[model samples]
Target: MDEELYLIKDAGVSPRQVRLARVIVGLLVLSAVIATPLATTPLLPIPGYMSAFGIAMIVVNIILASLLFAKGLIESKESSIRLGAAYFFVTVIFVPLIAAFPGGLMEAPIIGSNSSAVWLWCSWHTGFGLLIIRYATSSDDTAGTATSVRKSILATIAVVALLTLGATLGLPYLPEVFRNGRNFFDDSTILVPALVFGVNAIGLLCVMRMREEKPERLWVMVGMVAACIDVWLTLYGGARFSLGWYFAKITSLFTSLVVLISQLYGITRLYHGIAGANKILMTQANQDGLTALSNRRCFDQVLEIEWNRARRDKRSLALLMIDVDHFKKYNDCYGHLAGDDCLRQIAQQLLRVINRPGDVAARYGGEEFVVILPNTDAAGARLVAERLLLNLSAASIPHADNQPLGQVTLSIGVSATVPGPGASTSALALAADKALYEAKESGRNKVCTAPRELVTPAPPAFLMS
Candidate 1:
């Protein structure tokens, strides 16, 4: 029988564990109300009328538990496991209290110790209900309009008010009207519990409202729900209604333990998921698709930002523009696919040559690339460009049309300037392009530096005469 029951339980797994848990909890409450009184009455030595009344109270408890659990299951935003755990904890605490203090139970006519307990219980659970409602409706994004915050605050206040009224008007005085010539309100049975419930309810709502908008709010929601249920059961039971009294105590103990456990689990899951997502986004933004080096977009953004800083500090900046000679011809001869492979090989060579924190190489466009060298002058830039030419000449990528079977050469141009108010990025780029044109014009594969001096040619010899 046990094995069969376990199988039946195991088969019902789904994404919403809270939903399933609610169903199970509802059934347990139902069974407790129906079975407990019937079995206990015959065994107890109470009067026949009292026994019948006890049975009737059990029936009422069944109805109330069913209604509350149904509503909670359908409407509750809390996870099933959380709800289940809360119900379990509440039951544990209330069972012991009732068993230990049967005569101490609130009498029908007046407020007393039981009344206080009931008040606390109902207050706690009502607060829990408000939390559940808030959590279900709240979005993950908190930077929304102020209207959302105002609405939440108003809803929370309303919940607190309802809890307060329920404890004050329903628990203590209602029973007094049934008893002739006895003042139930004067007994102070319901007063202390009502006050306790009211205070706790207000505090719980305040704390919930104060929480920063985050998924973590879900755990707080669970705690509030457990606490609210506890208050409700206590208040109703204090009416000297047997079923209400039993359920009030039982559910309070059950709900507390479960809520705590659920909260811990939820927090852990939320943290890990958020951390993982952030890491993935960072990686994607920085990494190149083809070469696995920093791509052009990243290089452009980083260079502009660093350039402004360097300009402010009066530092030198150099740029190198490198192009693969006869790259288009090579692509035409061996197909575009081979050209891509050649480009990848050159990209790797650039990576090996430019090894500095502030130096970066990027594929500026088809068959052309750019390198930014911060704090480097024309001399430093020339040396780096020459080195890159030498490195590419040595690292021979396969080229069939050329004399060598696997030799690739690059024409590199170096341009440097100490940035001032008039020194724009476009001017620097143009200077580099002119230098690159000089290298290509001089020969197919060589390094060229832009002339530092602007020389005006002397008049032609015949014109001078």
Candidate 2:
């Protein structure tokens, strides 16, 4: 069976997360309530403050949009792509919106009209709410492809551009949002807030419907609730520079901030999960399955690394090629399952005899095992080979085969050398292999050392049972 990859959308929404969302919504509502009495109370007007806030919103929206776009592409979800386009639209429109504000970045407005900023603000909120609704209602049945998603995003950008241009060019024909050119208390201004409130309320409801199946929707719903409160405060304040207007802007920023935080948190969790999986995969790749020793692949890699290190440090590296003696006869008599158990026991004894941090033991192939001992001289290699033989004899694992001792035995070949500057790393293995063949040919149970000319062979120490 194929394993499934982790994605934030597939993550279940726990009860605690749901409770936390409720608590945040309650706090936002309470804050709105506290500021209600001072809604119309005028405060010091700072034009620079508006410009800074607008710029901050643009920056946040751009980052949020980019994150959503990446998430959409990675997960192949059209809903996420649509949501990202919504933020992108808002970001693009905000440039002119801030410039149109009185004494904004420039002394003159981007559009030569007093009420252009109000209209742009209304347009931004209304468009964002509609997009949120679109996202909430999108089906999850058909997954998005890369080409389709990019086309969708480009189309949204083109549409947003045309709408922004139309609004800017036709500002004179649009209904007036401010009667006194500065205050928002006029009946026409009331319509703006009412329209935004209705749109955002619908968006909030749409998000709520999907909250059970899509846990991520909980955060989106909270942001929508904040948007509704922001509109209500705008209506209550009824004027620029009023407490309600200021708090409303804060809530608007809070809406995007909450959603951005959720995205970051989910990405962080996915990163940790992938890191853990990679670690486990690396371990499995290097380890042998049956005996839990390093496999042949790992042995080859380690051998090359150790060989280079020995050449650089002028140290000796030893190789021990070991084979089970008359192992075919044992398997024929005891069955393959018993053969496997016998090999596992022999591997355990080999491990017990060669206890060194710099040593590596690996299953080379069927009925054959190999060991690498770094910084070991030929004499040390011989000592290790003898110890390995003694350990196996002590273990005395039964083998009902043609043998005088009637027990398992090994034929080992030992080779040790300080790698020369131009020596091929494979030379050490070739020499050890030759010695193993020689040992087997000499007798079924004995240790043999290759000729010194081939490499620095382990001293002539013949251990015969």
Candidate 3:
């Protein structure tokens, strides 16, 4: 469920989605079956019906086109861009188609002669079919950068605009599709619808062939099938206001809405998928792989934040820099896996000791760890360090390489300070490190406190041992 289904252009359809697609197609087929019998039966035309239907078609397709355009840019897929362009083409063509619908726009045909409506209808369906074919055949590979995709989309828009204009102005001069109010089946202009039917059938086949390649294309395929049926109904009805004509308009609406709903659902799922992935990535980046504690990077960030807060509040801040005794020797004797487990166990003990919400324990580096304690003085930090050591001793993890009393042990250095104006946080870390070196030099299992002067001290050599 967390998988980014939206990003996957060719993700296979699940069985559940397949069954749902079948149900939708079945309903479309059933509607076609009923409409077939009433194809030529004339019905009373409702005022504004075509205008309303045209507006709804425009709204649905434009929204769907925008969503696909966004998806194409996000995923860098050319197919989505091409598909979006196709929907946009249909949306633009609908404007002229509606305007030319006899008496629909202005009580007289708005843009062209009475026969202009049929010509525009043929032009729209043919152009839409060709665009669908283009989309269905587009490659799934990442086509280009976002910039290039945007350029392509703009170019396609320009081309669609010019095509729409050409069809509107040029097609009206061509031979009439049908006489003013003649039945299309009884006229020579019947060839227009027949040709459109063939083009749509080809588009449906192209989309059907893509079904296995891109599972989400199931919706597109369904839409294409409905489009073919719509045209067939228009052709069979042969005249305006026939039952098939109205049913054809209804089917057209169904075609666009189905794809629009699917896109909305996909985008919603993608948002959740990205959010879940980001949360996991953040956890991985901040936490140590081996010890499951905050890593050095997180420690550094938290130290700076807490240091600034301490300066503002004038409260004491403490740090404990802890190093496991003879850890290299332990790894040499017991292997690296045991060394890793030992670190994890030590981290668990630190977590147990530093119970306050403001305390942070993190792996500083190899065999070295640090704890930041807010509002705590030197005494509190030392007490917490001693508890960590006691907890590890109780675990009794054998380290034969460690001399007498030979279980794993730690050398801890404690430093505490109340920040003053213009003070650097690095001084606290340096002081803790100096104390840790001193603890190791004095003896392996011990604690040492840094002096208040916070001066650099001589380097200790016991690390190589």
Candidate 4:
């Protein structure tokens, strides 16, 4: 999961900003859904001539157009954002004049390019074509792109301003298209909207092909479909006051909704995925794969922790370094696969026997395991080693090649100490390791201890059992 979008940290949008944006988007969608049907429905007891659907459409369309512009400006990197901006331009600048007068001709300074419904349709498809280009090409450096976005915004405002000025000045332009009590397919209406929907569909397909992340792609795809539906209704769905026009408004609501829902869902999945990956990484770090015991890293950490505790309490700490007897020979005879299984069995037995709160059992290295017994004396350490041997023998794992009485056995070296100011964990570990070597030298499958004297070379082979 990416932090980029999930928490909005990468995008740099604050939570308060997102919430406010959402509220505005929500209001725009809800208004779109209700405005047309409420003003145009025939089920109401209002006179057909008094239908206010056209007025409602203009208001809702302008509001939706502004939202799209705001969204595109904020998300300047996305081509889909440009599509939103294009929608705003078409609705606020073009839709009103065309809806109000589809047949009114202009003959003055600047021509009304969108004076006809057919011309408006052409401009709509052109906007979507630009969107497709944006989606295919990744944007510039974010800082650079934001600058570009600001310039684009100023330009759009100017363009919008110019068109309004022209309309107000009665510049030369073609009349508009479609009206109540007017035939939908009459004079280029049917063909124009069909072409617009076709262009939108092609742009949508291009978007899906270029992107692989589904969450990011879903909203745009849905918006394109809604756009197609809106075009379809404009072409074949009776007149302005018909049910089709109302449904077209509903599709308008759908366009905004898809963006909100997909973004939120994408964020949720990211959080869960990151959490799951963290858990797996933690397990792999601390646990031994072959034996399922704490790995050497975990042993090192626990030993350091317990060593400090012993030094603080002025209590004795014991370490048992246990090695499987003739483990090389065991692997050679049984194969490495069986050797791994043998280690798992041995580790499981050790875990069951060493169940004290202060005891920590870990796989220290190949064929060598260790247990830290905090607050334990040599006597208690010996008892644990003995019990471990008994339990392992009781399990009766086979090892018929060598040893004094071996059916797979452990040689354990016990080291116990009361730590002082000069004490260190490495010194304790070295003492335990030497004790293990002595136990192996004396005879395999024996328990031995480091003697009180730090005389190094086994101190005459220490003690044995």
Candidate 5:
């Protein structure tokens, strides 16, 4: 069963895949660093560096795809943190590498020789895309299916928009814009990536806050602004003249993509954690803290709802209040812990017996329990009380007094009524309490019932005593 559950719930990857994904992303960052100087230096044109960077980027893409495949399996917080760190390292590495090398320094056909550079750039962006999609699609124990899916879709759309804008407008005119000129478009290229970065950074922060279930709109708004800036920068760069302008454009696009992907991952994780907490709360609410049975709150709700329906249709409602005989003495003898265990055992027995629909049982209070039997009459209630008494007595829960009271037993008080025009729950409860008192007086382990109406009679000697 454990294996089956794991299989059913397992995300499509194994632990090995998660480790590999981390290593791959890490290697990409390292490779990018090594290749950056060669590709950007005007004095040296290293064709090998471009290809190496491209291979590194491809490895990043593969890692991202692997993460996506194994999302279900990597649901733990530890796994998420590990993946996030890998992505963060890769993103940070890109800044220095790209900025340092700015357009492969060599004059001879370096641009054409740098196919690996383009591929590497594409790989990083694609890897980011995979991370975003993986987080969106990953199974969350907490969030409902609809909520998880909605957030994933929204994040994906936002990321795609940013990437598309960066590709179209930010890459082409960067050089002309940053050529130390006073032209409006020239200034725009330098300013655009910054603006986009600022927005995405804010967005990333918002996504982080959202994952923590905090109320913040700044991050989301920033992401929107960043996305808009990316589009503007892309278009302006394409029309610019400076070499620096084009570099800024591509870098900005890459940064925005990374931010979008990372933020989406954070939000998805937050949603899942919140959802799991809710389920735990619900489970606790339905259970009894002491005996692990249905508590009074659950019982009352079920009984009232069931009673109302039974009354509407003129069906019978039966109730039995079962009190442990000499429970106080038992606690005094065995200690509170043992008493608690005994109570739990009793509750379990009651739960097992009352298996039929419309039968509700609960721990009424310390040493007292109540069971409701809808569609049952006085006779049925009596039979149930007898069965409960016999079962408890046979169990022979230990009692100090061995002769008269040989074992622990329950004194059951039963009441059954078909609600009519003048029926009252208070009246029924009073009758059951009276019956319980009678059972205690008659003999400790016995069932008792109250007369429907009062009848004058001589007082007992015990009453006078």
Candidate 6:
């Protein structure tokens, strides 16, 4: 079971995502080093220039987070991928409020500011810890199960919103832990940091023990562990306005940087990879391997589309079923290698004849070909089948065992119909097929036409031997 888990993990991890994630992590560390020191500028304590840079970072982080989350939710989303979004969410929502408030990062540490600041601060780290644990222990991205990561994330959001409302509004109804808690920058609450640290420690353990040893996961574990230490320093390292506070702020910023950047990078790779696969699949489905023409599947799809269009628009649709005369005897005489060459030549001739727009020529099967022509009538269909015969006759390939001049030839059956309700399209195909059988029976090399009603006799004009 463990080996199976490891194999899934290894296959799921993308090296491109990991490489890009490393670049983001380095940038994040730099951002933390720069943003935290700027927080202590000797400017007014308003949400002005001092908080401007932090605000910008918060906004950018939010956008990136939303993209990661949307990608994870709609497509094949992974749990760790969602964690990156969760970090950005916490940063954008709570950090801005706390940092913008007076006596927080935006202002000098007031000894007794609003107690609500403490709860908001606690909420950010607590949310962060919970997201980490959720990510680390969640099922692998490749794991097929009844589990839904998006549903779980949404549920987590609802629960957090409820808890926050109770702690903020219903505080009067609860005890000391709920109401009037001291701000971290004011009286410095020890309980907030302790509880959050405890939460993140469990997260750290989960990340370490996850089946996938993706480097991005290790970076998350690093951020979690650093944040816990940062919280501890803020609580027990003495005064609120000391060096410990600065270090804590720096560490906290670094933590967000690590998780958010890596996630964005990884999600970007996943998006492009999925897109490439879809493109390849579409090509394989619609294209033929041998003659490089439309395959049977593509032919059927085009026929249906044209059939519906002709039905509505009252336009004529023509079909031609062309078969190589004496193809099997030719194969028996020269072997399959020459048979393949002969088919390629025939396919090229058909393509040359059906060059107009809305005309589709496809390989129906061995030595049998089909052409769909929209806005073409019975006369036009007959002309196309004649042109096809002339094109092959001009090729002048040797088929000695074939009768007459001992050269290659084609037997074509043309059918045309103006499609409408109760007028079966399958009947048109059957008529063309019947016409082909007639062409084959009357003589091996000729063009036969089957209109909406009766099958017309084959015309003996430009027949090549």
Candidate 1 lDDT over residue span 1-465, tens digit each: 334333323322244654645564566456455544432121222334333433333343333333323433443423232223223323322322232222433323133233433343434444444344443444334333334333433554455455445544555543332123311133444664565456546635654674353323433444444454445444433344445444544444444434444434444554555566656566567656666666677777877876786688888788888898888778878898888888888888888878898788877777888889999888998988888777777776766665443467788888877677556666667778889999989875777877643111234588778
- Number of residue pairs clashing in candidate 3, backbone atoms closer than 3 angstroms, sequence gap of 3 or more or interchain: 0
In candidate 2, the residue pairs with backbone N, CA or C atoms under 3 Å apart (3 or more residues apart, or in different chains) clash, namely: none
Clashes of each: 40, 0, 0, 7, 28, 0
lDDT of each: 0.55, 0.82, 0.82, 0.64, 0.54, 0.68
Best by TM-score: 2
Candidate 1 weakest lDDT stretch, 10 residues:
177-186
Point out the higher-scoring one by lDDT: 4 or 5. Answer: 4
TM-scores of all models?
0.52, 0.90, 0.82, 0.56, 0.49, 0.61
Q: Give the per-residue lDDT digits (tens) of candidate 6, residues 1-465.
A: 334333323435467655765675565456445545443333322334325435654765566466555555554657645564466656444543444245446364322234444555566677777877877777755432224444544665675566556555655663343223322432344455667779878887888798876656766766776677566555543333445455565666666666566656565555556666666668778877778778899999999999999989998888998888898999999999999988888889888988788899999999999999999998899998998888788889899988886998888888988886456667778889988999999986788888567432343456532
Off by over 4 Å in 4: 1-37, 40-216, 224-254, 309-316, 356-358, 418-420, 451-465
Q: Which stretches of candidate 6 lie over 4 Å from their true place?
A: 1-215, 218-272, 286-289, 420-422, 455-465
Model 6 clashing residue pairs (backbone):
none
lDDT of 3 by residue, 1-465 (tens): 235434433355668778988999999999899889889899998999889888999999999888887878777888888888778877877887788787677778787666667766777788788888988887878573567556755775676566556555776456655555477644565666778999999999999887454445988888988999999999898788899999999888887788888788766666677777777778889999999999989999999999889889989899999999999999999999999998999999989998889899999999999999999988888998888888889998999989887899999999988887435678899999999999999987888888856823333567446
- The runs of at least 3 residues in candidate 3 whose Cα sits more than 4 Å from the true structure, single-residue gaps closed, are 1-10, 35-52, 66-81, 102-105, 137-188, 237-243, 451-465
* Residue 171 shift from truth in candidate 5, angstroms: 19
Query: Model 5 reaches what TM-score against the true structure?
Result: 0.49
lDDT of 2 by residue, 224-324 (tens): 99999888887788777899989999998888888888888777877777776777678789988889899999999999999989989999999999999
